[model samples]
Target: MSKRIAGPEIERLIQLLAKVPGLGPRSARRAALQLIKKKEQLLSPLAAAMAEAVDAVRICSNCGNVDTCDPCTVCTDPRRDGATIIVVEDVADLWALERAGAMNARYHVLGGTLSPLDGIGPDELNIKALIDRVAGGGVSELILAVNATVEGQTTAHYITDQLSGLEVRVTRLAHGVPVGGELDYLDEGTLSAALKSRTAF
Candidate 1:
């Protein structure tokens, strides 16, 4: 097949953009064209920002949160509850829980869940680091904010088992219907959990 293509540079940009999570070839092409058309306002600034991020962004050494700081702002924040830690499956989960603004505790990103079939085990996650933090003995409670999926539950169980001998208490998030969700729209699992966790009104 003859290589029917635009300029090599533009083609390369489109190809790279298409590899992004939510973008496809057509959308990437459109995006690239827009970027080119608005080079001064968008493309150049985006390029500079990408370069700056590449230089500055890093994984936090203490909690596995991605930040420019080695310990991350969350870990270093004195206002946060130093005796409480919320464990999550990923950085995205950490951000989500932060946005909820329910707790002012520190966080530990597990990096991923325990998926034996996919060959992702405890060793692949930040489980040991979490144990180390717990064992060091300042934290009084460790809240497992992992997802409700099988792998997420498995990971939470494993962590709880690891902290069994420690003085710190371990807790998991309560499962129930979402904030705006109706009872009729909920799944069997949600309904069951909501019933099991029912409280007196």
Candidate 2:
């Protein structure tokens, strides 16, 4: 091991920071140095915020959304169209949809898509919760806004199979979405168009 200049504690923090997406060892080191330089203004508050988030944020019971409260703001909102629910793979997808401002329906985060080779099955995701939501009966449409990847299509088909006997209409994002592209990376206009032109799967 190279000489540990940061000491075990700070080195541990750097390692943990590096584990976050879009961050690497060098970025983490730079971040750690910046934090140490502004310990009182940045590091302390950041640590406190992280602790508070870790303690308070949890998966919404109804939709699998991470929120400070159960049911989440969207699920509990009276103004949202309860008759339509968009099914997405993660909170980031949900955020993307919201950012587009085209979807007035509530969302159900699947947590992940079906991946047999990765050993991730339907049961591992929030499929059961989605079924329950559909079964409760107010939803008239389910828009499958999952990614266009192979696993995403598989998961969408799985959801369609699950909802086959139900009265609710099931639709999918339009073909404009590029294969293997995540919704989070798409621009607002493209996402809006996809939502507007969604077709039956």
TM value for model 2: 0.84
Q: Per-residue error at 74 for model 2, in Å? A: 1.2
Steric clash pairs (candidate 1): none
Extract clashing residue pairs from model 2. Answer: none
- Compared with the true structure, model 1 gives a TM-score of 0.96
Model 1: worst 10 consecutive residues (lDDT sum): 1-10
lDDT for residue 175 in candidate 2, whole number 0-100: 62
Per-model root-mean-square deviation over C-alphas:
1.5, 5.7
Q: Which stretches of candidate 1 lie over 4 Å from their true place?
A: 1-5
Instruction: Report the lDDT tens digits of candidate 2 across residue range 85-113.
Output: 99999999999999989978999999999
All candidates' lDDT scores? 0.93, 0.91
Could you tally the backbone clashes for each prediction? 0, 0
Displacement of the residue 132 alpha carbon in candidate 1, Å: 0.5
